[model samples]
Target: MTAETQLPQATGSCCSPGGACHDGADATTGGVTAVYRVTGMTCGHCEGAVAEELSGIEGVSSVKAVASTGQVTVVSEAPLPEEAVRAAVDEAGYAFAGRA
Candidate 1:
């Protein structure tokens, strides 16, 4: 994975976590995928919010957040800086447990 420094603030909408319906017009627009363990996500709405924030990051191509599994997968052109992920999770009102 390559490196990505600063990330942009997230914008949101009512959307699913699947790479369909949102900033996910192209699943492979970016070439790298990362997974993180996010605590406090326990339902679809939680997943949606997390997905929104991650998908809004500049290099991100798609985002999949599974609240039941506490996993957030982010696809991007490069490996995102940990701080960026941390911020997105925070923006989504969750705790960043670390990479998965």
Candidate 2:
């Protein structure tokens, strides 16, 4: 018999199933939108942690993390350095897989 691993369902209006929180569009006015690949995110909590850490960086306007897709979208006033982004992801207990 094979044991199947099940992931916990994400709650909240944004992370919930079939939620259309982000359309994956670059809609930042006078800002830069960067999509980065992240690993070790398996639930909403992980998403929140990553977003929080990234959001703490200076010039960061907003951050959205989708655990299911292992993608993090960041909107900032200017282009951020890869080292900065990587440090933020590492602080969140995740691996930064670079730009997506």
Best candidate according to TM-score: 2
Off by over 4 Å in 2: 1-28
- List model 1 lDDT by residue over 1-100, tens digit each: 1212224424432343443344334232425557799999877778888888877888776677877778877768777899999998899899999988
Clashing pairs in 2: none
Give the whole-model CA lDDT for all candidates, comma-separated: 0.71, 0.74
Against the true structure, what is each candidate's TM-score?
0.70, 0.73
Reference-based TM-score, model 1: 0.70
Residue pair clashes in candidate 1: none
